[model samples]
Target: MSDDAQTPTPMPTPNDCDLPRRRSDFATFAEAIDYAARSEKGLNFHDMRGTLERVYPYSEMRADAMKAARQFAAMGIAKGDRVALVAETGAEFAALFCGCIYAGAWPVPLPLPTGFGGKEGYIEQLSVQLDSSDPKILIYPAEIAEMAGAAAERQGCEGQSWEDFSERPDPETDLPEADPQDICYLQYSSGSTRFPTGVAVTHEALLHNLYGHASGVNLGENDRVVSWLPWYHDMGLVGCFLSPIANQASVDYIRTEHFARRPLAWLDLISRNQGNTLSYSPTFGYDICARRISSQSNVAERLDLSRWRTAGNGADMIRPDVMQNFVNAFAGAGFRASAFTPSYGLAEATLAVTVMPPGEGIRVELVEEERLSGRPRDLSRPARYRAIVNCGRPLPGMEVEIRGEDDNPRGDHQIGKVWCRGKSVMHSYFRNEEATDDCLVANADGEVWLDTGDMGYMADGYLFIVGRAKDMIIINGKNHWPQDIEWAVEQLPGFNHGDIAAFSVETDNGEEAPAVLVHCRVSEPEERIKLRNQIADKVRGVTGMNCVVELVPPRSLPRTSSGKLSRAKAKKLYLSGEIQPLDLAA
Candidate 1:
């Protein structure tokens, strides 16, 4: 018999009822990890079938991290040096990330190669980010050594596989201490593909946001996390991974790819857990699960979600229709509508600007299309409304304001640009002074504020998001949100969320018009033309004008690293002739 066969199956880390939990109140993240190591709670890795594979205790993780820190010191890693790491969901990545903190180097978490972007595309993305970060070394999993190495070489930076890097000498060396104001890490925004900018977060800012979010959720006894979110994204890395450690909570994690294959396995893991569960995802994750279960039977018999106390929704616009569908599909499985916690945040804010308080599900306000478009109501036309989801109030110590075009604060229920001010806001876009100056504005009082680039409004202290300011389609001085057009087309038969990309394009007549690119599945030419015309009419009704509608093949629309639809990239690709529309019968 093989030694592997004889070895006993590993057990997961305990919930650590004996240890007193801290809400990331520590001075630095290194200190947070150190305190967490004293407890039994740690991270647990799961397979695609929701089976536990490896048990990583915090004590063991800290020990490994120290060794990694020593190895880094031996390699002449200096304070504030950039160590680029491909954010993989595992203990190795977690340990190395902490080790960089211990060594006083800023750990930069980059994305792994996604399914949509081929090898060369991933390599190019990595190379661009590496050039922006100017890292001393790039470390990634051995499985993608060839691609990672190529990217690192292209940018003239040292690259080593995690396995190879770990095998190096770990000589005794003193690690540097971290300060609250010192740069902790660099996080590249998920949508930062064409032009990348690294957002530098300090140790203080990270801990502040973590503590605020933990307090906002009222993290207490029996509260644990179950997540399949990719660590490369801000929500996954800060809210799930780092926050769990600082708060001293055990976590169950499934790889994002695994969850993509079997989303129900996420619920399976939650069902098996005895404690109160907290899981978060974008609207699409819930949409995918609800759609996948439609063709199956006996869902309630197989899954249980009664213990899911916090079902967080963030990283994208919260869709009320999608949320209702999820509730309809899983309410029988003990999923409560009240557990849905919608939040609003960005990478620049270090993860969360505001998180819905517990017990408040998806709250929304019905705003007239005229108000949303920044135009007066036209009495001749019937009123059209859009449901804007309330994304909760600001976190403790965070301030939110909606500003008009004059850069003055707008009143309640007035749609304008969203701005946030807090200690949790990022220090700057690393090495990009021009970009930093463009977004981070200072008042006469010398208080700095972050322009979130999102358009929203305030009502009774709650925030209701309209859409992205950059995504607003302006035609003949009338502002129209692409979401409005996309959601209108989705109302038509045979369409899904993320199936359409809408933007403004200039026509041959020197007039700007709305252009809708839809993912069409029908192969017949006549049906394609019908679908195209149907979509065009739907868009026309929304915008009150004729628009360009093209049917593209399915699965061609570009998505950000975190799986959010990238309309900017879609428009660029369509204009560059990279995204070809299918031919229809004349």
Candidate 2:
């Protein structure tokens, strides 16, 4: 065994000694009110104006939540009743969520889904999801109330717009008390590829995870996060919103749509607000910064970011160049490389699996590609291409193991399945028992590990993620499959047969750039040129990336022994330049 493998790392656990538990102490969401009440600054909601609008002082938010709780109780929402929320981020979403907790109901937060191919496509996808979960009540914005009401009617459930729901008087009823084990919220996965799975989180689980994260990351009342991540995503919901609330901190939010339209607005918001701690979009946002940072005269000089710490990099591949570009661009603004925290997490793990400890700085390990691909190779020799950026170590209370095909632990630098188990692992996938059992597993020792379905290894104490065990392509923060893109391209003429294989090739651009590769089979030289240009255009239309299309001869494409288009194998071949590339006119 190597020295690296022999090293034992300490796990993160709640400082129960510093803050021991008490039975009378609040364990569940019902107790969250008391928790907020104990805080000095009180609960605040910062609106788009950057004004500190007090929605509820700790006492007020609690009172409103209690009022809403009474109304929910009168409406016959019992404990465990799943309530879906489809509103944007605001005091309403927060209050509704807390109200659900006070009423002992489960709040299911759904991002206002839009931007599909068309309205019909959006409605279809929304209908499919509604059928899957089958929540009893749907709360949405007044503008989309009719749509939600119609959808709920179709699903045989009750639906009310936030306008009407908030109008009901506070009922004179006793709110149900909740235990620590009671479910708090159902956080649905982004569903970038397939149907979103609702991850059930208990009150104890959420509180423990939030407390662990806030303290471990050094977030406190003094910290302020400038966020554009959608409130529906785990990072935005749990990390930015809930974590800040738990710590009595403040956050400034930019609507995801507004940020998308003007990425520069995100930086401007941060600058204007003097946000001290925050997150980011991937290289795409870095590209936006590279474009605007130079044009905006003395912007960094104007913005005070010296207090800004813990700028987490995740929700997509972490591109080293992007981080470097961001740091270099804003170095004048007081952004430190030490503040860049490249983390590993998933919705299933309640948004955090492992966080690089603050102030450790970012670390990358360049390993031999052959060794990483499961073949034995010289470990000491510097490889032509290597994986970069070790994503620090796992969080406390979490155990990570790299196992080979036989489920035995693999040595350092050997790529295998990344498995983890801890208090943060979600309870189960709502309504999908088989998937819940398959992904969430218990070993003989009785520790339940969630199969991350990602392939990587640990070096020293840091965890490095390589690729997905599943054929999922993550662009930006969204996951897509080559098939999803391929299906979109097959709609174009001259590209119908097993003519194309779409896969992501790792780039030196750090982790953010998952270069999209389209291998299309074309016959004649002229046809190949035309087909390459045509395919790139089609893919860009669908995926919003300048897709690199390489035209090759029919049957030249690599495949598995079973004749399946192996994306992993194709990516390997592309990196090695084994496949022929038909020249296209530039």
Candidate 3:
């Protein structure tokens, strides 16, 4: 009592109001509606010009969403029912998502088909996800209505475009209130590289993450965000779309296609609109800075980014040099190093896991490669090391632990599997309890933690991601499962014996497709050149994707400290831009 009484309790203030209500139960659709209504600014989507289009005010969006909910209810989608949404980003996508929530149906947003080998490959993937999700209804955009309808027909599900069903009457019936533990949505990771797995997030989980991110990142009604990341991605959906709405902020959204074609438009939009908070593709967007630096004289003097607060880096591996280059290029443009927040997150954690706190600058640790790859090391000795950016500490109410292969907790700076458990943790994989159980493991203390499948360790209370145990490759901020690419190349004649290594390289442009370094054991230079072209053509044909192929002498590929081929190390070599290319006839 003497010691306790000596310490004074801190007084709660306005910032404390930003803190979330700590609870186990999830907020229902009704709660979301109420929150939107209570927000002073209301809800609307802005274009590149910052022209606010009243897609729906807080009340109208909710009412429209509820009406859509009634339509879904008529289709037998009740509370806990699964509904799939496959559409581009627009007012309809948001409305359908909210409608599913209001109907007590869980929404699973699928990636629009792209980069597939062909239409057949696209159809195959679409069928696989549709079968896996087994939703009651498939909602799609009018433009892609025929393809979606055919896919749904093949899967024995009803499909309709928004235009077809938007005018349907709102069944004026009150649905059952969703419990906090109720599953909100199934976020599918980009299956660019492997079969996409759906992460089942609960309503409570999303609310907690949204609250932590909004407050921690200092986002509020005053902040305006302009985003081009597709809604299919966790960063785009959570960080750009939902977070803004949750924080009572305004958001400006441009189509991903438009941004991809006109990268400069992103900056132009930001400058023109005076958007304060935003995100971008690290590789593709790095070009924006380079183009500005080379072409636009006195860019820094011309633009004002002083109002920008959080420039989050995630969805792909963060490149140290890229960040440095961007900072140097834009130094005169009012962009500060302190604003670069290197972050780590996955689909399983409702988008954000660890965010480097704002104003911390970029905290990175340079660890010797030998020690990081599991070689026995002397920690006390000073040695040359590779630098890895820190993803900061866990958010309030969340706990993180690094565990070894034996499942026991690992000590500081020891690489192992990253595991986490919190209010934002997902409930289960939709319908597949076996798969869910494999991911969500129970520890001795009976706490269920999600296995992130990412390899990383903790040091001095901060988390550092090394690589993935699943062999996933992130190119240009897009996740491409390595096995998928390998499968595409393995069909070629000369690519056997694992002669092909597909991994990501952090180029100045952003993370491009894994540089396909092939070890074609041919001696003749001419034959090797021909093989290289054949392999490249095969990869493109099978995956309908473009990748840089480098033919090196046989046995040139590097291996991990554990005798396995190291993609991370190979990527390092590729970035140096010294890998000799075989002169192949185009």
Every candidate's lDDT: 0.91, 0.66, 0.67
Candidate 2, residue 20: Cα displacement in angstroms equals 14
What are the per-residue Cα lDDT tens digits for candidate 2 across 130-218? 77777778888887775667677777778888878998877588777788787778887653112367788877767767766665576
True-structure Cα RMSD, model 2 = 13.2
How well is each residue in 1-586 modelled by candidate 3, as lDDT tens digits? 7765654532211111233432212265357555654443333454544344444455556667777888887767788778888847777888788888878888888766553224664566567778988888888888777677878888888888888878766656777778878888887765211236677888788989887766556564346676777887787887776775566555566766666466555665566544465554543355345544666677866567676677777765565656787778777777788988877777778877887888885777876655555544545644535567788878776789999989889999998889988887777766777878888888788998988888789988899987677665644334454544554565676553345678765456664666688776777768877777787787665334677788776656654211235565566565665445555442
TM-score of each: 0.98, 0.75, 0.76
Best by TM-score: 1
Clashes of each: 0, 10, 9
- Stretch of 10 with least lDDT, candidate 3: 9-18
Q: What is the lDDT of residue 31 in candidate 2?
A: 67
Better model by TM-score, 1 or 2? 1
Q: What lDDT is reached at residue 183 by model 3?
A: 82
Q: Candidate 1: list runs displaced more than 4 Å.
A: 1-7, 192-195
Of models 2 and 3, which has the larger lDDT? 3
Residue 10 displacement (Å), model 2:
45
